[model samples]
Target: MNPGLYVFDFRFTEYFQMTIKPLLEEGKDGELIDWLKDISLLRRGQKCTNPDCQGTKPMEWKRARIVDKFHWSCPLCKKKVSIRTDSPLAEFHCSFKIILETIVAWCDGISLEEYTKENKNVKGVIAKRIYSTCTAATDWYMQTHPELTLLGGENSVVLVDTYPDGCMTTTPHNNNYTKRVLCVADTSHMPARIWAQLIDNKILDYQKLAAVVVGHIRPGSTVVASPSLYPLLHGVKGMAEVISVEALMALDPVDYQRSLKNLETIWRTTVSVCQDIQNTSNAEGEQMLRELEWRQVFPTPLSQILHDLAAHATAISS
Candidate 1:
């Protein structure tokens, strides 16, 4: 009897420093700042962002002190930039420690409100950002990825569908209505190959669906869609379409059954994950999309998610 890989894992920090550190070590601002730098997210200097230094300053790093907490000195221009000059969290005003703590809370999967109670030094918005920027980041990921420029390939299959994302609770000021979002995922690739647009409880027609998906799909792959989508995609060129169960039935029965089975598995997982989302905010749809990507890469409870977050947040030199 051997345990699986996750069973004996010790790769993640089991205790949050802010929550459990006082009992084990000194809790002070200086220590916290050192910890932030140790994670590799914050640095003492960075490449100058000055507009005038065009390509000439290939590797010129500026050194400047940030709010007296960190130093960033520019060697070429002799001007100082913020330590967080080029990372994702660069624009935010919160301290580096708060950002790390907020991210940890999010990975732990407790509501943002609860995390605040444990750490008085953090703000609600910071914790909320763990949930907030995901959608934007996801959109950013799609726009930046080369494969997403054209979504389809030799053996690609795309599954498109929309389902209710549950209704908001009744409040005196709010009406109860079920919200929906568009899910067009390329099942050909394992996890990162998906895009979502939140419709705020509204549904899209077939023509609109085809238009949106066609751009993301590649030039020469077969797309399998529902009967309702057939009319929308009939004459679309540079791609092949398999529309409806009837169309699938026309194929070899053995292959058709296998296809149906795979389709059900993928669709069910997507829906089930979306449904697990507790917050119905329009932003959460995108966050869920991003979380899906993270889960695929890390593949565990939120702690593993935190490991990746810490790595990405701290490892940038810029």
Candidate 2:
């Protein structure tokens, strides 16, 4: 009878039945529903937090009035709640299905306009909400999961590299914005433990770059970066190793190219293996292989050995 809580549970149930269950078919429906029931609604029968008033012995579900698309009000407490109350989707005007779709699109790196069009919704609202949600989720994920934070404290080994990606066209100057991605990875080679920033310029300004890097990377952590970034390392005491590109390029050109090619091949193969592992529910094995593949791309001497090991392990595991 409590519309606020009822609507909340109903929405959750609808989402699971319509979206999640089909995707995770291996999971039991009853179990999932039970799990949902625990966090699904904010009911009035739930003991009122007010200590002084003990009017009702057994609290009842008091129907709440629905205001807008999501806003609602409880009759007893006059408390306001959204349809998404107590859930991450709370405060969102979009349906659960649209939110799920937007999340998927974001993970796949799809544009907001594309996602909005696909869901047949107002582009401005969808875009704004999706971007805000993504940024918040990213922040929350980094905070809750330390392993996902790429640049750990000073003791951490952070690797910084920049690669030229495609250009962006919508700049105020109508100039092509070169995409330089700055990534910080641990020595263990776990999936990028943090969000990578796409830098705007092609030139690597040491001071500016160092500020950004130092802000994220913990002090005293060994920062492995190219010589171009050495300027930024000034004044920053502690373990910061700048590897010279010339030194790496000094190797036989053919051999270097061969190594790069081999690395790319291994990386692609590893991604395929990961997909297969996920399909078979072998997440542990997939994680291991992903780590191995990452080590191969990282600038390290053991890269070749690790790549070989990953190939053998894949074969054996298969």
Candidate 3:
């Protein structure tokens, strides 16, 4: 089946339930692998790496009952290469079902335990590796997509806040704290936009926080933040005009409520993500937040995400 026919806004779970699960139930694994190749998740049209072939011939995919499940075969030279030989999936030694299911779980924000509960065949370590690959894809998206990375412009208003979090330390008795500075760009029409960073320093000085925020926000937009941030952000070079949350609340209640509404959503969602965060070290917390930020920024369906990963496969590696 052509993947284009499945281009709808259904959630990943729904798609998996309706499409992928049936394929597995019917034992049509090869067709599923073909679909993955169709979406570019598995490597496609790759040239054989055998020295005898001299990269002159395209490799054909051959399905087998091998550990990798698939390989790329050169007809002329009779050489074979693993389907994941040079792709981002090189290090992954799991089935495509596990890999795809892991992507769905990651996108749906399903915890590892929850995912394993539903799909008992998946081992925790393999699932974690897939989750890491998803994070790497998000990091690549943030680094390369400037339009999504930088928020706010001309008439936009960005709601700003800081979240206190604990970081992990190697010393068993020592602990460290960091601030997660979050900026939610509210355009009043478009879906909310977000930019987040974990400040390495413990100090939450206005100047330091403002400097970090200013870089992500565009000029001419207004920044609605707590009073402590006013002085540093109000008149900084190339920075947006700053307004205290209280003042914005009083002067323009509609916009104020709108910004607050978005901020509240972000806070509530992130707080839920960090609820059991005390058990996890700071590094893990940051990864969770980064994953959240990624979902907010892209908000694409599983197919689109797969296509994106395939398109930028070289940049995102295991």
Q: Best candidate per lDDT, number? A: 3
TM-score of 1: 0.53
Residue runs of model 1 more than 4 Å from their true location after superposition: 1-40, 43-126, 129-139, 143-149, 165-177, 199-205, 246-261, 272-318
lDDT of each: 0.52, 0.42, 0.62
Per-model C-alpha RMSD: 9.6, 15.5, 7.4
Model 2: lDDT of residue 87: 44
Name the lDDT of candidate 1: 0.52
TM-scores of all predicted structures: 0.53, 0.46, 0.73
Cα shift from native, residue 248, model 2 (Å): 1.8
**What's model 3's lDDT at 47?**
84
Worst ten-residue run, lDDT, model 2?
A: 1-10
lDDT of 2 by residue, 81-146 (tens): 443444444445654445444544443334555556666654567656754554343333334444
Tens-digit lDDT string for candidate 1 (263-300)? 55565544544554435566655666555544443433
What TM-score should be assigned to candidate 3? 0.73
- 1 or 2: which has the higher TM-score? 1
